[model samples]
Target: MGYIDLEYAHTCHVKSVSDVYSLGVLKLEVLIEKRAFSQAEEEMNRDLASFALPIIEAGNIEETLDRRPVPEPTPWQLHALKHVAQIARCSVKFAGKDRPTISEIIANPETACE
Candidate 1:
């Protein structure tokens, strides 16, 4: 659950989309095994999603991923991770206008990402 839900900001007023955004953030949290906000001193308590978006946007997915690798995951796992990150990136748009609707979010992993 994110403290910064879309409802809190009037600029974007889509409830289902907001929920998708939260899910995206949760995906990152679960994948990276870190809090939503990073406590690492250098990061200055930045939100993990915020910290990761640039990395993902830069096409550096591995850097934003959990540091502890699991004996080299399969290619499909890596692809799925990248796809989930893309979904997360779309979900956490600063403006709701840019975020995907819940329906799109639901379909992306199975169709769009594939």
Candidate 2:
């Protein structure tokens, strides 16, 4: 998977945390409507996490979001999107230990949107 956790390079072993991280990348891909890696004019833009994480952490996740919704997102929808983005942010941390458990990632978004 293009979304494989970066820490896999050193360990060459798969861990549950890596699954969490990849799920997070999937979440971001859904939100941003971009693949983990793709053809783009800028090299950095080729990777969704590299391109969007800093923007997300910088508090501008909306900038990375897909904007094709017909009427634009409602406030509630925007809130949910932001919450999911936060989960994605937590999922893609460089260190596996720094990433949230799969359960936390799963629960947080459901609770957050409530």
Candidate 3:
């Protein structure tokens, strides 16, 4: 999938969050080594974008974390990941008016709390 496909789908309305969703899904796919979507109906109902919200909100970002051994990401990196998760949550809000503009998100200071 690419930007063109998304643009054609009118998905650009929440493009940034959708991009974040895609990244999160890809990361989960890599971690699980299987498409979590196929096994559970609930998972299928909620796309990757929606699926990540609860996990992130629960502050269990590491629960289904990638299994492959890799160097630990710094706290800054984890904070950045959480920030993206927050932005994605805001972006995917049902009402477009509720979504934060890119500028607003950029202006906010990063916080360590989930």
Candidate 4:
């Protein structure tokens, strides 16, 4: 659930849109290759979502992704990663209504599987 859900979350108030937040968190986990909030690291910015948001906002999402064994990402991979990051960034909107509905997400060019 998102901030809105957290604010008024109960069995009755839960809605399908709440899953949008879970999807966002899943996206970030895939991109970061780490737990959403782990004690494995000692740092002020331990939340992957928070850590990745600014870079995504500034169009530097590539910098936030896990380093690869390959020398560099291929053009297709990089493009795909960018799209995935954008979806992840969009998924985590503070308000549930602000997040994309499942249909919108599935149909979105950036998020839809190519």
lDDT of 2 by residue, 1-102 (tens): 458788885779888899877888898989988888877666644677887888887988776678877347888898888888988888887788888887
lDDT tens string, model 4, 39-113? 554754366666678888899877767775444678898888888887777777656666677888887756442
Question: Clashing residue pairs, candidate 1?
Answer: none
Candidate 2 C-alpha RMSD relative to the actual structure: 3.0
Q: Can you write out model 3's per-residue Cα lDDT over 16-48, one digit (the tens) per residue?
A: 444433444454555434453453665544345
Candidates 2 and 3 compared: the better one by TM-score is 2
Q: Give the top-scoring candidate (TM-score).
A: 2
Question: Each prediction's Cα lDDT score?
Answer: 0.71, 0.79, 0.49, 0.68
Ranking by lDDT: 2, 1, 4, 3
Q: Candidate 4 has which clashing residue pairs, if any?
A: none
Q: What residue runs in model 4 are displaced by over 4 Å at the alpha carbon?
A: 1-13, 69-71, 111-114
Number of backbone-clashing residue pairs for each candidate, in the order shown: 0, 0, 0, 0
Model 4: lDDT of residue 54: 87
List the candidate numbers ranked by TM-score, top first: 2, 1, 4, 3
Candidate 4, number of clashes: 0
lDDT, model 2, position 33: 86
Which 10-residue window in model 3 sums to the lowest lDDT?
Answer: 1-10
**C-alpha root-mean-square deviation, candidate 1:** 3.1
- Candidate 3's C-alpha runs over 4 A off are 1-42, 65-71, 106-114
Q: What C-alpha RMSD separates each model from the true structure? A: 3.1, 3.0, 6.1, 4.2
TM for candidate 3 is 0.50
Model 2 global lDDT (CA atoms, 0 to 1): 0.79
